[model samples]
Target: MAAWGQRLAGVRGVLLDISGVLFDGAEGSGVPIAGSVEAVARLKRSRLKVRFCTNESQKSLGDLVELLQQLGFDISEGEVTAPAPATCLILKERGLRPYLLISDGIRSEFDQIDTSNPNCVVIADAGESFSYQNMNKAFQVLMELENPVLISLGKGRYYKETSGLMLDVGAYVKALEYACGIEAEVVGKPSPEYFKSALQEMGLEAHQAQ
Candidate 1:
């Protein structure tokens, strides 16, 4: 798993995790944490691929690009994963459009999911992106579908930010599951599905992992 994290100083290769790995602390301070941004720039100079695999869940690549730029890290939309897009890709491929419950930015990506189908993928991310209305619809849809697929398996509560510790998306996800009486399907990595996809994206062969 990339969770072990590739060595930043030595490798002229993939750089996963944008905020903490590239910049210091968390959002706002935008200060480069001890050689983090430099490490990325160094890789870029050396032509190494820096793919930022984020469980960020919400926010579009454009938003990420702007934030990265604020911190003086030169990044593009291509090297990021906000999960919403990946979710849409999954549901679309499954031939199902999900009635999503997530942040505003994340909801944009749901356009790709086929809402007309009975199987609706209910989604949620951190922050105030989700609301009562969305959750209501999400539960209603789940009741109809009986087992709505969840996009994120992560239940992490709060991440450290420049300001301080804050709530993470997991809380809201749990709330929906409680109301809907269904569990979510995790689509991204660390989950075997996502982890394998990361490896495949990196063009690495998967051996037996303990």
Candidate 2:
């Protein structure tokens, strides 16, 4: 533990994972991990830069802020980093309409985008909405488009829910990929680009963050 601390001693900025670290989504809602709020307060007291990084694609940034606040975490919208913003940027750059397969809770995040002639299938944690009909619709969209793309917010396999381990979006993304014979573009955590962006947002180089 001492060696571990030494290794992370000079980290100017801390990028923290939201699920399983700060809180657990056991009940389908964030259940704050013991000491998490106080730990964050301590980090703030230390004047260390902190950012919450999550692969959760089921909530908008605003919604995440609210949830964190409600759970007694001192976090602002700016301090939260999730895949939605980056995904939106990619969508805009590619100029592709989205055939979204995300949760209704997060649908508003893509409200301004055009979906009239979708050529991209964006899959995320659609929860109960990941039904056969919706999957078929997304698959159909991909097949029909001249050169469609498959975008996955994150490729996490499972998450701990109140009901125990539950399948995450990766499973569904893989299924779609299998059916369509196209690989998904993952744009969330574990992606080097995503890490770089988060570090950049902290005004630090990659080496300065941990």
Candidate 3:
């Protein structure tokens, strides 16, 4: 415990995962975990800087923030780093027009991007939108492209929600990858760059947070 404390002494920032840690996914009626709100408040009061990082793509950033606030979390839209926004930045930077296979809630994030004549596919947690027809359509687009590009918001296999374990975007992404013989570029959790970007936003170095 002493050695662990010594190592943590250098920590200056905290990156909190929104789902599972704070609450269980359930659209607008998400249930918060016991003490998570108070824990977040304590973290905010501490010397360490805090940032909410999530792979949530089914809802807009504003909506997500509003939900958290309603659950008594003192969160702001700016302090949260979600996959949809990050994916948007990447789409703009690469100038790739994507045929989005994402939820309608967060579609506004890519409003500025051109979806006409899509050269790539951006798949996220589309919830019920991940229909057989939609998947086949995305597969067709990728197969037709000379250079198929698949951008996955996150690669989580599954996540626990209020009801039970629910399928995440990774499963669908892998299916497309297998069919198209192409790998997807993951832009959310488990991506080192994503964590780095969150830490950078908190004005801290990699060594300062774990």
Candidate 2 clashing pairs? 26-161, 26-162
- How many pairs in model 3 have backbone atoms within 3 A of each other, for residues 3 or more apart or on separate chains, i.e. clashes? 0
Candidate 1, 1-210: lDDT as tens digits: 464554333444463776556764444236677877777777778656556776665566576678778777877786665566666677667777666665666555565555775577556563665667766776677777755666663556766778878776677778777877777676655566665565556554444221
lDDT of 3 by residue, 1-210 (tens): 999999999999889999889988775579899999999999999998999999998898999999999988999999999988898888889999999998888899889889999999999999889999999999999999999999999998998877788899999999999999999999998999999999989999989985
Best model number under lDDT: 3
Runs of candidate 1 with Cα error greater than 4 angstroms are: 1-12, 24-31, 46-48, 206-210
Ranking by TM-score: 3, 2, 1
Candidate 2 runs further than 4 Å off: 1-6, 26-28
Candidate 2 global CA lDDT score: 0.86
Q: What ranking emerges by lDDT with the best candidate at the front?
A: 3, 2, 1
Itemize residue pairs with steric clashes in candidate 3: none
Winner on lDDT (1 vs 3): 3
Which of the predicted structures, 1 or 2, would earn the higher TM-score when compared with the native? Answer: 2
